[model samples]
Target: MPNAMTKTTSLAQRLLRYGLYAILLVMAFVYLMPLWVMLLTSLKDVEEIRTGTLLSLPGSLNFDAWGKAWGSACTGGTCEGISPYLMNSFMIVIPAVVISTLLGALNGYVIAMWRFRGSELFFGLLLIGCFIPFQVVLLPMARTLSFFGLANTTTGLVMVHVVYGVAFTTLFFRNFYIALPKELISAARLDGAGFFRIFWRIVLPLSTPIIVVTVIWQFTQIWNDFLFGVVFSGFDTQPVTVALNNLVNTSFGGKQYNVDMAAALIAAAPTLLVYVFAGKYFVRGLTAGAVKG
Candidate 1:
């Protein structure tokens, strides 16, 4: 009787475990349903899409949608497709991420280690800037960019993005660094290491996790930014997000559902790929720095 009761308990536990696993699997499917639909839509022909059963197999697998999104899709008279704007997206997002993350690391280190007079105020001002909406600053930022002859260009978009990103990036790194031990930094300084030396050798090397965190966050933010890209960039310098907005908003001949889905997916592809590939690093970075801090 005792053995039978134990067996029953064990079986019940196994059943619960299986139930939880099934629930989680269903949740994951729900989350990924849109992507699955989009992929199928991208593969389908216009006729199949018009039939509007998103789960159905494509009557014919069409790479043409991919081709059109990448090139030959019309945005007005231009047929350059999403390729040029996709390049422009990279041109801006990469530089913006690199420069801003680098500068943010510098700012965070100085505030954490140095902590001199007005440094608090400086950080406070940055904090305040983070609260201010980008829209409120748009006119001033555009004016500033125009003053620097960078308005309506890729360079200008990068500059604005970096400026906006700096405040948030500084916040991330500052939180992380404050959690770290002071001794490692203090000892290096006591040994007559200059600011640059300590940062370059001790602090920066240890910042790998925070760096990855910032990179992933900043890269995604900059890549998906449509407002700044549209406002700061001219037609020639606009990113894929803007082109995608155009593609969705303006349709001719017929509403090309397959084409629109393909374009949207194309616009999101890089960030999605980056997240999938870098997700491990992102998780590692968060815990490593936080534990040390």
Candidate 2:
């Protein structure tokens, strides 16, 4: 009887594990359904798309839509496609990401490793910047940008992204640094290492995981930004997001769903690639950073 009971218990646990796996598979399919639809839609021409359901495979796979979307799609009166705006986004994102990450790292190191009065309060205030609604600052930011003659330029957009992104990056680095052993800093001081030397030689090398997280986060945030891009960018300096919007909203001969979907995929591709490649590091960094502080 005891032997029979053990067998039944093992069978039941196995069944439960299988059931959980099945549920997870279903949830993943649900999440991926939209992406599947978008790809399907983007492959079909306007005629086939009108006749077929969204989930149906294209009767004939068409690559012209992608080409058109990338090189000749209309945005208002301009038919120059998304290529230029894509370049503009890269320019803004790279500089903003690098500048913000560097500043955040310095700020985090000082706040975490050095002792000073009101430092905690200063960090707390910085955290508040992350929670505040960006909408609240648009007017003031615009005014300031105009005052500085940076309105509607790529430089202004980069500055805006860097300013907003720094708070989160600083928080990430600060938390990760807080978990580091204090003895390491003490030993470095004993070796007559100053702050910059200790940071460059000891701390920065150990910061690979958190640095990956900050770069990925900042890249995604700046790349996907539309509101600031729209408000701050000029006709010549608009980012991919704004261009994609213009392409979708422009009243052409007819609504080109395939072209719009293709444009969207192009706009989203870089960030998706970043997440796919560095997702493991992102998770590790978050876990490690949260372990202590």
Which candidate ranks first by lDDT, i.e. highest?
2
Span of ten consecutive residues with least summed lDDT in model 1:
284-293
In the range 102-137, model 1's lDDT, one tens digit per residue, is: 999999999888889998898999889679887898
Give the per-residue lDDT digits (tens) of candidate 2, residues 245-264. 99999976888899999999
Ten consecutive residues with minimal summed lDDT in candidate 2? 284-293
Model 1: colliding residue pairs = 179-293, 180-293
lDDT of 2 at 243: 97
**TM-score of model 1 vs. true structure:** 0.93
